[model samples]
Target: MDKENYTAWDSAEFLTDDDIIIEYLKAALEENDPAFFMKAIGNVARSKGMSTIAQETHLGRPSLYKALSGERDPRIGTVMKVLAALGIQLTIAPRQA
Candidate 1:
């Protein structure tokens, strides 16, 4: 494939809408891997504006970027803070047998 023939896409661009972001997060949660959440949250942070999210969560921008990076695991508290900042609340649903 020719490099010029392909266009690059960023996941964050697809998360421009609130409903889409929520759905994306739900899908990520369903993946059942801890790293997926970090990657999803990182994509969200990028979509929502890292500086804004950082300010809302009272976390440093650079640290937030580092924590949400897929290679590292962020604390549950940090994840909660990010979710809260994004106006998302986690709810438990009983698994179907």
Candidate 2:
């Protein structure tokens, strides 16, 4: 069966708030998948305007696009810079094992 048309899903459309972004990223990170983390970051970036984040991070818009494109593995330093640009800080805590 062929469907006429379907709208593509965009996580960014649903991730609009900063707090939500933080929680979403945290949960996604818990999965321990780099791709998921990258996608989550990309969603927040889209919500916040990639250009604005790029400027704040001193990164080129195209580079940001590629880094957060959900395919490439972004360097930890790059991720930290992006988080800082978003006015968020990353913290480490022991996971209950």
Candidate 3:
């Protein structure tokens, strides 16, 4: 197998539309891991351009990167800002028992 023959797979490349981003996020949320969700958000942000997201959120690029890096727990306010910048909204629904 020639490694150069195949390009690496990046989920960010496939997150090209709102519907896809929503579904991707839903799957990440189902992982039941905050870190995973944060990383997923990072992927979406990268797909949409991190610089744009940072500007929209009024956050510095480095700050945004650190927050969404999945190595640190970001504040809820920061998370909300990032989601808004990404044109994503969080909703509440009754969980299936």
Q: Pick the candidate with the highest lDDT.
A: 3
Task: Give lDDT: candidate 1, residue 37.
Answer: 84
User: Candidate 2 — which pairs collide?
Assistant: none
Off by over 4 Å in 2: 1-3
Local distance difference test values of all predictions, in order = 0.91, 0.88, 0.93
Q: Specify the poorest-scoring 10-residue window by lDDT in model 1.
A: 1-10
Stretches of candidate 1 off by over 4 Å are 1-5
Off by over 4 Å in 3: 1-6
Q: Which tens-of-lDDT digit does each residue in 1-97 have in candidate 1?
A: 6556666888998899999999998899889888888999899989999999999999999999999988888899999999999888998889757
Q: Kindly list the per-residue Cα lDDT of model 3 for residues 5-37, writing each as its tens digit.
A: 678888899999999999999999999999999
True-vs-predicted CA distance for residue 44, candidate 3, Å: 0.4
Between candidates 2 and 3, the TM-score winner:
3
Candidate 3 clashing pairs?
A: none
Model 2, C-alpha of 17: deviation from truth (Å)? 1.4
Candidate 2 RMSD to the correct structure: 1.7
Candidate 1 TM-score to native: 0.89
* Model 2 / residue 87 / CA error / Å: 1.6
Top candidate (TM-score): 3
User: In candidate 1, how many clashes are counted?
Assistant: 0
